[model samples]
Target: MAHITAGVATSHVPAIGAALDNGKAGEPYWQPVFAGYEASKRWIAEEKPDVVILVYNDHASAFSLELIPTFAIGCADEFQPADEGWGPRPVPVVKGHPALAWHLAEKLIQDDFDMTIVNRMDVDHGLTVPLSLLFGQPAEWPCQVIPLAVNVVQYPPPSGNRCYNLGKAIRRAVESFPEDLKVVVFGTGGMSHQLQGPRAGLINREFDNAFLDRLIDDPAGQAAVPHLDYVREAGSEGIELVMWLIMRGALDEKVTVAHRFYHVPASNTAVGHLVLENALG
Candidate 1:
């Protein structure tokens, strides 16, 4: 059985990328924010995963407030980049691993995990920022992507436990894949802080570290944590931590945490990264 070799979690702040590359993102306050993705970049270079399963929530770009699916998988052949405020990045449309994606989509449905399969959709900075940080916008990226986009932008979002269960389903889907391949699973977004209203730039390192500790030592306990707790304490949009639970549930119990980093105020969000070796002996 093919196994997931590495797992990474990152925050996607479009302004951070913009400031890193163009030196100006209209927010002078966020310019010197130290491009918070160097570790993920180095990890990709070291591991060179064959396929990357990216779990990220769209910001009402692909799926609007009009309709939201609990969990959606991108089964498209290619995904064009969408413009948020500064416009889309100058990169080729993302190439998808349709064969694997389709198989996984069907398997998720078969496994009693309802998932929305999308054949045509454009990716926004949510999916593109990590790619650019880790792989840069070369003529082609080093690894193919299997996008698992969650509906986090809207209210009544999927529960934290719900996302965790999806990870378990994803593990079954990937391990059952017939091809000889190595995989990397990514759970993107959140640790603390909020982006809207009066609560913007709020950082809670205490809550963030507590969540990280539970994620490795006791994931079930972590999964049992309610979404309301995260929203109230970590901020409303910080509910995106639910996505991290998805990545956590996909891994085996014995995960060797090798490298970890956490920081705050990265474009009105808290950023963190974890590198876990699968099935630690």
Candidate 2:
């Protein structure tokens, strides 16, 4: 049966993607951010999973005002990089793990999670930035992906508890798949910063770090945090942190923190990255 080898959580700031694409990663301002992922890059190369269940949100790209999927899974053969105003970042097209994705969707629905199974999508930076951070500039992504797009753009996004429970359901789906595959689940986005209003440049390092500690040591308690707290304290966009609970819940009750990196001022955002491995079989 397929097993979840690990879970990764990271902030998916668009500026990070531009830094990598424009060859600015080596600059002092960007160096620290890139340094945060060096260990992750090497680790991924060594522990190459058969598939990655990338959990991220679309920034008004695929889903706009007309439609939004609370939870969407990509079962397409491949996804093209999205053109988010500035044009598509120079990156390899994402190849999807269709067989696994389809199986996951069916099982998730059967388990009572209403998921929109997408056959096509143009992946935005939320999905690609994390890949770039982990894989660097591979000519092609090293492994197949199953894009799990969560709707964090709209108000009333799925609650922290809901995401956490869905992750448990995902774990059941993954363990039941009768295939010899290794999977890694990634929860991407947020370390506290707001992108709009008078507080466009908010960064609460204390709050961000405190949240990380809770996520690692007491995720159930972290899941209890309300949306207003994330918005009011962390920043409006910081609500993205709720997605981390999904990755946390997918793992065994105990996990070993393999590597972690945190840095701030990444173009109006605080970047955080974590790598956790299941401590139990």
Computed on alpha carbons, the lDDT of every model, listed in order, comes to: 0.79, 0.92
Measure candidate 1: CA RMSD: 2.5
| Model 1: residue 206 alpha-carbon error in angstroms | 0.7
The per-residue C-alpha lDDT of model 1 at residue 70 equals 82
Q: Residues 125-197, candidate 1: write the lDDT tens digits.
A: 7788777767765888778888899977777778877888888888899889999778888888787878778
- Model 2: residues >4 Å from true position, as ranges? none
What is residue 20's positional error in candidate 2, in angstroms?
Answer: 0.7
TM-scores for all candidates: the values are 0.92, 0.98
